[model samples]
Target: MNKHIADTKNNDVIRPTQAEAEAAVKTLLLWLGEDTSREGLIETPKRVAKAYKELFSGYQQSPEEELGTVFEEVAGYKDMVLIKDISFFSHCEHHMVPIIGKAHVGYLPNGSVVGLSKIARVVDMFAHRLQTQESMTAQIAHSIQNILKPLGVAVLIEAEHMCMAMRGIRKQGSTTLTTTFTDAFETDIANQVRFMTMLRSGS
Candidate 1:
């Protein structure tokens, strides 16, 4: 799990009640000049509260535990295992708007391998939270490196943030790219090039 995320769990904080959360949504609607009493908006707060539970559920997940079960029975296979273009939806921590993206994750196994879906699940555990592309990339890479103890981990994420697309300058299609490399990938330029080559080849 990421350090910032883990800190929140260890810290003393009072979480708001569901009704309070709904009330906050109602306040936002009112601020937007939408009458909560109107038929169209009457149930929106409740619906939003429910939707938020699912959207930000990553706080309740443990990435370490998700990658805990690994298989060491590979037939002497030691090579790069890459999963590319895994789609994810996250909200920017700054503006609370959608940051839609895909992640490319790769790692060199030491002597074992994790289930392929587990890699996707790890991505979700980080994505289903308020994040920045840079921080999220580092978080995913660190979690795999720490838990799986792989020879190296690489995470590349490209995202279009709604905060940029829907507001400010309103550049709708601009994308942000962030990458993190650990262990062997960090030390070896050739490994880094290989990861990027593999990623570009597939695209």
Candidate 2:
């Protein structure tokens, strides 16, 4: 099992109850000049609260726990293991708007390998929270490195931020790309080229 990081600051804080959260949502609707008492809008606050719970559920999960089960029965298989095109939806921490994207993750296994679905779960776990693309990319890479202790790890994220497309200097169809490489993937040119080639070939 992987060692879990202790989040003392967050754990020590008390969060508001569901009713209080729903009330806050109502406040937002009122601030937006929407009448919350209307039949159509009356239940919106509760619905929004429930939706938020699902959107930010990453706070309640442990990535280490998700990647805890590892299989070491590989019959001398040792090479880059890549999982690409993992679609995810996250909210920008600054604007609270959607950051939609896909991630490509690869790692060179040292000895053991984790279940493939767990890799996607790790990506989803981080995506279910308020995040910056850069931080989220690093978080995914670091968590996998910490848990699997692989020879190398690479994470690439290409995303469209609603903060840019829906507000501010709106540039529709613009996308952001971020990458993080560790160990061999960072130092070896051949490994980098191979990873890039593999990604492009699939597209």
Candidate 3:
């Protein structure tokens, strides 16, 4: 665990115990007029609490630490290294509904390169939290740029928010796209076009 994550205000707040979390679920079930003593519902609260722990495990992780290791012996290969079509699942902070998406991460190495899988793990770390797609996109870009000190970083995410699809308006199949660029990518328009071209052409 990173010291930064350990010292955050979120960690400073006393967290509810598992039993307490299950109790809250039971309360919600009661509010929904469900009979707690019924066999099908008896273990639902416990199961829900367990499920939530896994679903939101991102809060327990540190993206900085995950992207910390870098290989300096990349034979001086300092071009855009992109990992595309990396699937992810997240929950919307507002409605707690699922956000199914694919994240495309790219970075220009500054002499060294981080492990390819590390980039995907960083995406998973953020996706396991309740998020807005826009915020998650920036977080991924900044984490790579700040930790790797890359020449530039670019993140593009295309997601379907279940909050809109399953509830309000109930329109399905609509997707949201978000992007963030930093350093060279932000300052140079040609780099942006190259990135998008590579993405679209699947090169």
TM-score of each: 0.94, 0.93, 0.95
Q: Stretches of candidate 1 above 4 Å error?
A: 1-11
Q: What is the C-alpha lDDT of each candidate?
A: 0.92, 0.92, 0.92
**Can you write out model 3's per-residue Cα lDDT over 48-98, one digit (the tens) per residue?**
999998999898898878987899999879799999999999999999999
After superposing all C-alphas onto the true structure, candidate 3 shows an RMSD in angstroms of 4.0
Give the CA lDDT, 0 to 100, for residue 33 in model 3: 92
Best by TM-score: 3
> Which residue window of length 10 is worst by lDDT in model 1?
1-10
Q: What is the per-residue lDDT of model 2 for residues 1-203, given as tens digits with 9 covering 90 to 100? A: 23344454387756777787788999999999998999999999899999998999998888889999988988878999999999999999999999999999999998899999999999999999999999999999999998899999999999999999999999989999999999899899899888888887973
TM-score result, candidate 3: 0.95
Clashing pairs for predicted structure model 1, backbone only: none
